[model samples]
Target: MHVPDWLDAARQRELLEACRRWARPPAGLRTVRTPGGGTMTARQVCLGWHWYPYAYARTVADGDGAPVKPFPAWLGELGRRAVTDALGPEAAREAAYDIALINFYDADARMGLHRDADEKSAAPVVSLSLGDTCVFRFGNTETRTRPWTDVELRSGDLFVFGGPSRFAYHGVPRVHAGTAPGDELGLTGRLNVTLRVSGLPGPAPGGGRSGPRA
Candidate 1:
């Protein structure tokens, strides 16, 4: 479901500023290379647990050796509230969300159809959109093809998918360029922050390889 205008102007400004800070250094936003060797157009930063091509680690395994930024408690609270608003109080009480993937999209950026299968938990995923609007394709679990729904996600919208839709395939086909929420917000692109529960037994042992920046 999509909840439009879920966050007021002040809240949007606050989160946008926070995102700018989170997009720096160590675990900051960077283009991601898939296992296929191609790079994603949208830059991403992970909190709580760092996400590489196919695994989750405590540190930026593919970038600097520094630990990923800690997930803010307030963000978790926001996620809870979002879930409660989209689903119900029972879900909010049961969800122990611990991970967040923040993706920034420029005018030409787009995401391919994919599933959030890396997570071990069956908890619902809460997605919050800020800035430019986008055509979000929600597909079935079996494939990335047809029989999907296209939803236009505008700034301050909240979308929660769980239960039967937890493992469904989804992607951003396109982002409306130059459609940000005005200059007052100090943003020029789209910011999508998705909250999930990693449900990992524990953080991976031994630090990741210290590699050059991607």
Candidate 2:
């Protein structure tokens, strides 16, 4: 589902400012290195849980080794509202949406077609786009080839995929640089914040983390 202009200018600026802060040091934005040893062009930062290639970790296992930033309750709330608006209240359950992957894309950056299959939860992915426009390719679950729909996602646009499309393959093939109202939003590239339910085991009773820190 797509919702255009979901966030007004003020809200877009607010999110841009937040992304600027989140791109700071410690467990901040950095290029992702896949387990296959190839580095991804887009930079990324994580909240609630650190995403390292094909798995989740509490710290940047592939980078600075800092503990990831905590997931903001308000961000999760925004995702809930997006899901409710896109998929309806019946589809928006009180799932503990904990993972947020924010990616920065320049004009040359392109993400290969892939599936959001690492997380255990079947919850929908709530994606919010800010800054420049991009070609978002939504593909099937079985393959990453043709038979996909390419959607033009602009600033303040919201895209939520769930239900039968929860594990579908999707990616950003190209970013239209300078398409953003950079003078106002203070962003030249594209910013995508994807909210998901990690579904990893919760914290133990003693304030310790549960599940494998893989």
Candidate 3:
């Protein structure tokens, strides 16, 4: 579990721009209320298919009603590059990182401690943070007890967890207001995108995850 401080500003800007485009409604971004009665905006660009914003499985129809944003292959490559850079190119090839869950955090946003256990793949989750700073709470998989680590995450920081760290309970306790890069960055709020590969039975195709099994 290591946080890379070498992610230069230019790279950060590149990812930020990509997120802004992905955050566009229809193309990917959509707002929904959380189980706790809070709200969260999600951008599902890739990772094959997913029932984003919703925790259930359903078929998503595409029509004039709601435009669906196709997942960009380039972003998949970007995720690969991130893994290769952090865990070496060879390891990156073996890593499964296809779906990215871009979450927008408001001033009052907070994520309770939980494990990313939905996906069957054991590959590490590559999380990128842009705009604003927040305290990340990392806990163990066995229990939400002691041995928890709270770390500060700022813009352009990359957090990767694999091997023994995968399946660990982690979340954002809070997001500091007015911490984003501003208008120039095209990002007005905090953006956290987590790239993952969903290892469903068959090869998952593009389109909304709310659809019948192919």
* Clash number for each model: 0, 0, 8
* Structure candidate 3, residue pairs in collision: 47-99, 58-210, 58-211, 59-210, 59-211, 60-210, 60-211, 132-179
Please list the C-alpha lDDT of all candidates, in the order they appear.
0.86, 0.86, 0.65
**Model 3 misplaced stretches (Cα beyond 4 Å):** 33-47, 53-68, 181-186, 204-214
Query: What is the C-alpha local distance difference test score of candidate 2?
Result: 0.86
Worst 10 residues of 1 by lDDT: 205-214
Error of 1 at 168 (Å): 0.5
Error of 3 at 2 (Å): 3.3
TM-score of each: 0.93, 0.93, 0.78
Ten contiguous residues with the weakest lDDT in model 3:
56-65
Per residue, candidate 3 scores C-alpha lDDT tens digits across 109-137 of 77778788777788778888888888889
Residue-by-residue lDDT tens digits, candidate 2, 1-214: 9999888888888777877877898999999998788999999999888988789998889999998887777777788888999999877776557888999999899999999999988999999999999999999989988889999999999999999999899999899999997678878889999999988897411222321110
Location of the lowest summed lDDT over 10 successive residues in candidate 2: 205-214
**How much is the lDDT of residue 72 in candidate 1?**
74
Model 2 ranges off by over 4 Å: 203-214
Q: Model 3 clash tally? A: 8
